[model samples]
Target: MAGTVRKKMSRFNSMISLDEVSRIVKAYSWKKLSTVEVETATSVGMIAANTVVATKDFPPNPRSLVDGYAIRSAETEGSSPADPSRFKIVGKSEAGKGFYSAVSGGESVEIYTGGILPEGLDAVVMAENATVSGDTITVSSSVKAWENVASRGEDLSAGTVLVSSGNIIKPWHLPALTDGGIDRLTVFSPMRVAVLNTGDELFPDAPDHIENSGMSSMMALLPWRFSNTLWIGQVHDDPDDIARAVKESSDRWDLAIITGGSSLGRKDEVPEAMGIAGAIEVFGGMRTKPGRTTSLYSLDGKPVLSLSGFPSTSILMADLIVEILLEAITGVSGYRIRERLPISSDITTGSGYTRLIPGTLVEMNGRTMVAPASSNRGMRLGSLLNSSGIIIVPEWVEGYHSGDLVEFRLW
Candidate 1:
């Protein structure tokens, strides 16, 4: 039965433009994943499930930005070194401890940085700008109203949204969330992915095969790149074995990635096996170099992408397709870092196909320029390591020349 299924699907090969494939993936109605509550410390890199609002004003009260004296601005008007104005220091305010008394005319409160400004005080005079003599502060410079005072709600007000739903939490966002009194956040549960390496030549225990296998590299990279990923082990070129693995993995994981057997050769049985496993072929091929054989499938609404066995091609195709799927599920764009840089040399491409080339940015003549690491070859592992990003050549454009600006998609 499996042999007949494989034979029928082998003849079902089709090709489509990359843009059309992207549009198709985007158009799918993806159900939102379940949510989980995590402590703010561990929430970095997770997508927020709900908007986080500030419960109270940041600084909560007017505070001093410098170690100085809090006084009414009118008292310091027209004061300078030549004609200093002296005011009695009636009290002192420190962080977490406030001066309960208000500042009256001709009186100031000695305050430190982050200290709450006493009542009736609208300005802070730097210590260097004033001379102190036993309970008296002499101001030599005029301070404008609200100067050096971090006003209440200046940083964030109550009910202000600190982070919107679907935003990927970053390290820098931690401080703001902590200050907003958010101890915990609701975030989408990390996607669970299963990688099934289909090939008779590969073995998990064999060092030589593992070193050369794209599956091995993916096992190490996927967890860091996305979320939880499990290596469900490898399979030979048997149609039944591949189909069984695909069905089992799809049933348990949010996504299943099958590496190898994605091309047109006789041994390439992944596309057929996927069909036998009840996966509808979303697309069989992409019009992109190094990864044109890349294919996508849907099993019970979950995604399963079949990638070429060639090492570099598998990695590049994953970057493109997996990122799109992740964005669809998590509502976060994959490329956190992208830049437009000048090409250091000319790159030619076929007019009908989109090309992706690995390259590294180099400093030339005091300007940052991108140098193509190597041609778009599937097995060029050296180029993959040396390159910091991929240089994309669109289908409409034939190529790019030296000094021409191009978009570089960072890894």
Candidate 2:
């Protein structure tokens, strides 16, 4: 049955628009990965598999927000600097140690920051605003009900959802989760990806070629952003060798990426080799500049993305495709940070295709502006090295003029 499905899909050679490709990528069904419980300290960068709920109120009781006196609001009413109201300080309430007695109408409890507000006390007066003498406090300032006091459940109520499922755990989320009584979290295991570099002219050891290879930079970029990626090394531009390398790696890894030989040249056998390896081509090409030859395939249940060999094109295509894959697998979106900044100069694009141009953001005359990086060839590595982000020119829009606002994806 699977073989028949593959055979039918093999005839699908149509080029898809970028929007259609994005939709197809979003609709893909991802295989479930195993989940593991880890300490909150170690869970940063992992996707949460379960929502975390607050076990109790954040403060668990009404607490003082300042070092002062906890008293009934009426006790401080009609008090002034010239004619102050007097209250007998019966006891003190320090943090973690609550006063056993209730505060009466003429009484107040000396309370420190984080100290629990005693029963019948609805306000607090800062110590600086009161005069303390012997066992009595004279308050000249009147406080309203619940003033300077944090009520129970003010920060987070018991049973409240602190963190939603499918969220990528960040460093700032740890303290809140910890305060809500969450010590451990269940998160999806990081996806394992295999990268294959296919080309006949490529040398693994040649310093210049290796430095210029997209595979080398992608190898560093992938593990940092999306998954545990391993470069299975390069294969000669032979259909059979490429097929074997892809098939073997796809079986062991969650996804496979083939860089180089993705274009339509005679030596560009990746798309054909993907079929020979029992993979179904989902899309052959995209209507996008610098990466029009980008292709996606499905081997068994795993996805295999074939990207352009050019460094600039390969980087842009990987960012787009891998983000979709990450969202599908983890139920969380990658590339979360996007900024809209004004273009520093006029930019043009082809009429029928989307254009992705590398850009560097700078402050000019006290305003943030993005300028396109210079590169005569799309294959050059200089543009990518100097760029902090990429400008996305939509398919319908021809271009943008200077001072036009454009959306950019930061690196």
Candidate 3:
């Protein structure tokens, strides 16, 4: 499958970069599709529309923070635990219930936790702390006004940025929306994407056995991070078959990715198949190491990235290029590469390529260190399984050793 397309093509661009590939693949960039109305409670795990606001102040009313007796400040004066003060409880208040009467100097209102503060009452004394006799609750000690009252809008105001645009909704956010008095919101609707893998040999690796087919995981991770994803399965290495697949699949999806057959191969028909479907081949290579086979093109503005078949190459390409397209298409930015530091080590860089060395990051003395996962590319999973992240060795830099300061990416 190597060099078949390049060998036959009349011309191929001599220079290509990862940035160019990203721009091409992200052509249409997050075309908004139809949105469905969802209940605020059920909308958990969905996206947020513009900023959200509290329709009414959270708690909406001043409520008691504890089960206690509500009373006026002047009435509780000259009270102590030993010489307790007694008062007449005019009425009782429970959660969701409110007392409306204004209290006189010697009277008190019975208030429970979450109960609305009675009218003209300023403070509350705990039920256990006060002694109740007849309709009166004794004041065990002097109380201050507003001491046990939850003020209106204390949790949230009528208007606030509950959530902003471009945020992937989490389950906890739903309660905020509910508290904010939002029944429904205009969230960035889920992005539907098609994962079109092309190759006779590009089979999904055995669950127990891993392969460079990591592209599938890499591709799937994009939608997982942003919106909806559909695995369209693999197409035989036939131009007509591929073209037909692209046209048919494009109807149901917002973005389409054709992996595996992007490069030069006797059976590599993806580029031509895309061309046959009237799609533009933006570029077909990158300057990055472990991913020279990375390519990008688009059909009717939808994104399509071609990743190398090697696991290391596909994973790196997906994290960098495919992830970029996902962000562009869904208006979502994927997680950044995090770092930890371990031991410091240096590597020799070959003259031509920009190398991405697999490494573990560990933090020591508040500084991060980068240790090589391995010099070998095929055993990436070994490093990935226990990795901190890649220790990026620039194009021209030679390497480093122990005690050398290196950047880290946390896993």
Candidate 4:
């Protein structure tokens, strides 16, 4: 409802370009979703709602990274195995304990890994490099300042951002957050999404292949990609039922995706039903192959996507366009890894439309290459399992030659 436009256009002739769709979506005033505070270690798969900064240095004090003797680097500057430097062992430092006395030029402190260094000490000579006998240590090689010693704030300084807003929380993030003294994090609550399949041929037990493909794919992907809680339902090819389902979904869900009945076919009632549901049209269609009928709308301040009935078309549209909308609304980013890689073979696309070809990442002569998948062209269910990524061909560029670098996204 908030980002809706009241304009009308011929679905087939006046389809908007993909660039225009992106511009419009970017211009929309999408507010971030609600947030909840969760323990940092348990927040994986959730989107961070705020930036988490370090409260204190990761290493609160200078500490030893190895079991070694803490000594001044200058004391062993010219020492070698032929004429070794000597130091009198004064005290010992273990984890959670620090040697109180400072080490002078000829003195050293026995220190274990993670032990706080003695005062005035700036380096550690690893145990293997030193031989000790009754309070006397002989260093075989020279030691540099800060060698084997972790300095204060070496890993993370206070005020350093541990995690940024709009980034998905990952497993590796937990240690960083904890090291930064962040025990809890504010993350966006999981968005609730609904997939409404509309086709007269659909049934609960057995459904049309195309319709089931779109529904099942969305069902599996929503949780894995955006972490959205999903609901699946179906309606017959009637304008009233479609309108009712659309309205209900808008009232109860964050986003609703209606597959099938989006094209300008005799049985396609979604366009007319959207009007009945008081949905404001964002765009009637997009200038893209296979998903040219993909449309977007806003109802009650919520996003509603209308995708093609074809399997590959609907799935691709959901993956590309719906993800953008979700990011706009949720402030989450970087769900897929993008790469610029060489193509395994030559490929061509239509002149006026941006083409998305499902592809496989292959190793040709030990280098990863992108090759267009054969099943994707026919929009078969096998395409889903076979393709590992999508190769994007710009609308202006007609084709690419073998070995040409192109952009793609791993699914």
Best by TM-score: 1
TM-score leaderboard ranking: 1, 4, 2, 3
Candidate 1: 10-residue stretch with minimal lDDT: 203-212
TM-score of 1: 0.91
The digit string of per-residue lDDT tens for model 3 on 1-411 reads 335555634223553654455565556444455566667766655555556677878888888899988888777677888777888888888886677877787888888998988777878888888887788677767788788888888878888777676566677778787888988877656667677766666545534433436545755655342467787767666778778887878877776766676554455566678778887766766666776666666677666666655565566666666556645654553245544344465466664555666776556668756667766544365556676566655555566667765556443
Ten residues in sequence with the least summed lDDT for candidate 2: 4-13
Please identify model 2 stretches exceeding 4 Å from their true place.
1-13, 101-105, 204-212, 223-226
Estimate TM-scores for all models: 0.91, 0.89, 0.76, 0.90
Ten-residue region with minimum lDDT total, candidate 4: 1-10
lDDT per residue as tens, model 4, 1-411: 222222222456788888898788766765456778998878888888898899999799999999989999988988989989999999999998889976677999999999998888889999989998999999978899999999999989999998898899888888889989999989887777788888876765555433355677777656653456456578887889999987865655777888888765566577789989998888788888768888888886677888877766788888888668866876668877899999999887758888778889999999999988854345555665789888878888888999999988888
Clashing pairs in 4: 1-301
Q: Which stretches in model 1 have alpha-carbon errors above 4 Å?
A: 1-13, 203-212, 223-226, 376-379
> What global local distance difference test value does model 3 have?
0.67
Collision count for each candidate, in order? 0, 0, 20, 1
- Candidate 2 vs 4: which has more lDDT: 4
Worst 10 residues of 3 by lDDT: 206-215
Report the CA-based lDDT of candidate 1 relative to the real structure: 0.81
Candidate 2 per-residue C-alpha lDDT over 1-411 given as tens digits, one digit per residue, 9 for 90 to 100: 666445434433466777898788878776666688899888888888888898887888899999999889987787899878899999999998999875667899999999999998998999998899999999887789999999988988879887787788888889778878889989887777788887766765644444436676677665452367788878877878989988776656887888887765555577679869988877788878878778888887688889877776787788778877777767775445678999999877757787788899999989999998855455356788888888888889988999999988888
| Candidate with the larger lDDT of 3 and 4 | 4
